[model samples]
Target: MAWFDEVAKFNTPQLRLAHITDCHLFCDIDGEYFAVNTAKHFSSALTHMAQQPLDAVIFGGDLTQDHSFESYLLFAQLIADSPLTCPVFWVPGNHDEISLMQRISGGQIKSAKRLIASGFDILLVNSKGPTPAGWVSEQHINELSEVLAASQQPAVVFCHHNPLPINGYLDKHMLENGPQLLNVLHNSGLVNHLFHGHVHNDYQFKFRSVDILSTPASSVQFTKHSIDWQQQNMGASYRLITLERLNTAEPLCVKSELIWLNE
Candidate 1:
């Protein structure tokens, strides 16, 4: 069945979503990445998310570390077994396979890229590239522009790569055509915010008027500007975001908070 076959309505005044990223799951159930148990941390994230009354959940990207199909299956199984009833919108990271992700999506994890919730249009961008670096093609930019041109509603875009540079070691892996993306958003005048994952740590900045946020990884986080992983006690984290309009005559308001897991 298609993801949008049965469209659901969000009657609430506000729409809330939990954004988790960089799960980096392995094929082996007990496998560990950099001494961190990816599966256990992801499971913990799911458990925590299930407790919240969320409208949706966004899996930011980097769903696997070893690029194994079984790892994707493990990711699907974990979501299916979780108590979260909200839809999961996802994008592919550099480490993920497009075909495998599509195959497992459409249930808890939806395959749809465009979402309409609470009077806002949430669009997902695919920034995955052939290499570790991110790239957004001209076609994608054009499509996004066309969509924005046709819609007067507020927009929130989600993607796997950071469109702006952080001036660190990870900058090489950022979106190659970030300036083009910013150009579109700058011209659209409808996009209020942009959220992404690839950085492995929390980041906040502004490109013109758009507020950009990067979520921390659910498995392990990399130290900023470090060439190697310096083992420390950086735990898994996720972002909780709420979108609402105080009045019919006003612009949309966005509020976000970063939550860190004790595990």
Candidate 2:
């Protein structure tokens, strides 16, 4: 699943996307064992990304600490307040409370929806359902069917959980219906890339015909797929995606490289 990576490049023929996820911002960084100033780390990361030309920024979810209202408002403001002039899209997570986010002020939900409508048709692809378990039901699958059917530009999807299991144990936390979801995506005939969050470790893999990608959480990078939580690295980080659409009738080519906050 090695995507074409160019250390020096900017924008794309049709879209310059910035994919970030799992901010999980806390009011303070002094948690018990983990001291993660998620907001500040995210702010610094945005400082770098905002300066670059972008078609839109797509956020895979987990924007707050335990889905707090203030955290969501603050995160929404963080994006709106950024120097970026492009649209922004969001997909919810198990750590997010959708209703609270929908009510947050200053275009939290509106801005995301506008991006979905204007640019590449986005599928929210809720990965938070069955809260305790990782799963995307058949209903969401039907919605994806219609969404991809209606998309004009290449479609980009964001979800809280990865659909492809990277390892055995974490496979227990992947979309329970991952096989089905992937099958539909491969058949949808329009999806160009599928970006995900949840593993807390950055990885790229191929499942069927689509490129399956996962990003490190903005607040933590877990130890590579182990049941021992004690072994997790839990560092602060995020990613900067550089997309290049070749000047051909073919679909766009997207390659994302990491910009770690701890760096």
Candidate 3:
């Protein structure tokens, strides 16, 4: 219960979540990143996400491209204007400011690290490092181990950075101590999936038994496996994930798909 908030759990059999990430919004409402209007796309994503009923929304980070407090305000404002009623759990990306984000989180927007919904334990992990790369400190790993041990429910880990090399331009910024984090997840045997952002592309693969998935940016689309910064015309996209009980012995079955907008 240390990491989980004191919110009531959903009594439903399935948990559905909308994972939106890498908005890279700026302080200015009309700001653009690589000629893509981040605020506009983010607003569009919110509108699209609001159309569906979800248990929660995982804002996977890179919330601010300008690193201004006003950028965070704009993010909160967009959510406030949307029809999303479920809890929004967020983590920080390399370009984000934790202090600024904390100032803007309240009400439906939360800073809670863990959530219990639909028979699963969802954990939010901060993989932000000093550089653009990611790091999972021993302290955080220890905390994660303790949290997983405390619960018998199947676990899902959410972080801002991918813990493994994606073989893309963003691979250089993959989590530095990724193996350590994977070790914890592998050892736990309770973790079913590891979700993250920052790759700016839709990616999925498995590390041993655990599923590792990345959500695309709500702002710009990045070409996968490109050595340089390459843009694609695919437009903004987000991931929708559903977790359901299979049986007492089998882990929660994960079903995911990408929702594209303004293409």
Candidate that scores best on lDDT: 3
Candidate 1 structure, TM-score to reference = 0.93
Q: How much is 258 displaced in model 1, in angstroms?
A: 0.4
lDDT tens per residue, model 3, 1-263: 44344434666657899999999999898999999888889998888888887888999999999988889999999889887778887989999987888799889988788776656778888798889999977777888888788887788889999998888788889999987898789889898689999998988888877889999999998889888989865677899998887465666888899999865
Which whole-number lDDT from 0 to 100 does residue 22 have in model 3? 95
**Model 2 whole-model lDDT (C-alpha atoms):** 0.64
Q: Would you list the C-alpha lDDT of every candidate in the order shown?
A: 0.85, 0.64, 0.86
- Stretches of candidate 1 off by over 4 Å are 1-13, 227-233
Candidate ranking under TM-score, highest first, comes to 3, 1, 2
The top-ranked prediction according to TM-score is: 3
Model 3 residue runs over 4 Å out of place are 1-8, 246-250
Instruction: Estimate the TM-score of every prediction.
Output: 0.93, 0.81, 0.94
Could you arrange the candidates by lDDT from highest to lowest?
Answer: 3, 1, 2
- What is the per-residue lDDT of model 2 for residues 1-263, given as tens digits with 9 covering 90 to 100? 11111111223355566777878875443332255567766766677677777666667787876555777767766766766566556667777776775576233233243233223444556777766446776666786676567655566666778887777455666777777887888888767578888777878888778888888876666677566553243545566665544554666566677766555
Model 3: colliding residue pairs: none
Better of 2 and 3 by TM-score: 3
